[model samples]
Target: MADPQEPRMTAKRFHARPGVEDWRVLFWGAHAFYAADSLTHAVALASAVAEIADGLDHHPDLDVRPHGVTIRTRTRRGGGLGPLDAELARRVQEFARGEGYRPDPSTLMVTGIAVAQDRDADVRPFWAAIMGYEPLDDADAVDPQRRNPHVWVHELTPPKPGRGRTHIDLSVPADHAKARVEAALAAGGRLVSASPEGWTIASPDNHGVDIAIWPDFEDFGEDG
Candidate 1:
């Protein structure tokens, strides 16, 4: 039997597990993206996942689509990924594999807009009002219906003088980050920077965007 008091799994540890290494497990949290064949197939998979989650007393964020389903699991109470998430991911993948649905990290992408401001209070409301987004917190606003990407305000000291104060943040599965970066580079996007967390690619017009591999956990800042 597993010890109930065991420490939660860290991002590094989670990626080292067999079978899971192939999945798009984020370094900041635990998540898995699976692709289905059709809407009917997605619904069926979600139903199965719900049953398993109910049995385990653990639930995951499920986004069902006409041809794909994304699963994100985290320890809400603990504020990060835990052993429960790992177990749930394993079970979910097992079921997905059995159903002939392979893990497709390329299909899952999260977009966010970042604004650099000297004071968050100075500019948050304007963007929030214009975008019709609700305050996720003091620093960020999100679409009430979850249909649009998030908008984040970052406090920068002595704000840089330039018109390009905003940039797009793209979160992709860790396994596919390099491929995505390469594709962007091939398409005239220049590499601004690179790190284990992700890469910053600039468009032909000099607009910057980050290709992140980590899961977008609220309140953890861009690093998450």
Candidate 2:
């Protein structure tokens, strides 16, 4: 229980003002996230959000919860869902993605996934010897038709440390982290965590991916 002097946290709701359904304003409703299970959790969360917002120039309507905070950031001038709102959503999403949160599919779609092959040198050497594909300028080789056909490889900075293998990272809308986890589980993916950072899911083959749910692209400051 919170101390008597502690600030009380309550549930709150935010809705668009009537007749403000324009795409710029109404594209998204209020956003929500669960805070950590402690009083200091709210303070830390608010501080982090304030820093990020200060950097972005965009502001959000926030509700403080004992465990987490819910933020609704949409451009009233835009009316419903505008560039600013989307950019904020993406920025938040990227932050959450880095933290391993998974989004719900009902709430979002997997925009992209990157497979980082840390052992490019070793892997490339073996593949180049076994296959006849010509080596590329970057030292990473690929068969245009046989490979992902969509994925592009790039150099790793400083090289990967001991024994790191490939890893999969998934992206989704920021608000759908929970829903995405449920969907992936329903589709034969296994749930790994229910922590505040987000959820994790893995396929039957032991192939695991992080479903990072973030806001749409327009929310970031540069998107302007």
lDDT of 2 by residue, 1-224 (tens): 11334222111111132311211211233353534556576656666666677787877755665655555565432113344454555565555445543332233232222334464444555555555544444434444332221122444555674443443555444444566677788889887765544556778777767665433222323211
lDDT of 2 at 153: 42
Q: What C-alpha lDDT, on a 0 to 100 scale, does residue 54 get in candidate 2?
A: 75
Task: Predict model 2's lDDT versus the native.
Answer: 0.45
What digit string (tens of lDDT, one per residue) describes model 1 on residues 1-224?
23445555566666665656435544224656677788998999999999989988988778889878887776633225667777787888888888888677677677789988764236778899999988764578877665568888887656554432789998777766788899889999999899777899999999999987755322232122
Each model's Cα RMSD: 4.9, 18.1
Runs with alpha carbons beyond 4 Å of true place in candidate 1: 1-8, 17-19, 26-29, 77-79, 119-121, 129-138, 143-147, 157-164, 214-224
Q: What TM-score do all the candidates reach, one by one?
A: 0.77, 0.32
Candidate 1 lDDT (Cα, whole model)?
Answer: 0.72
RMSD of 2: 18.1
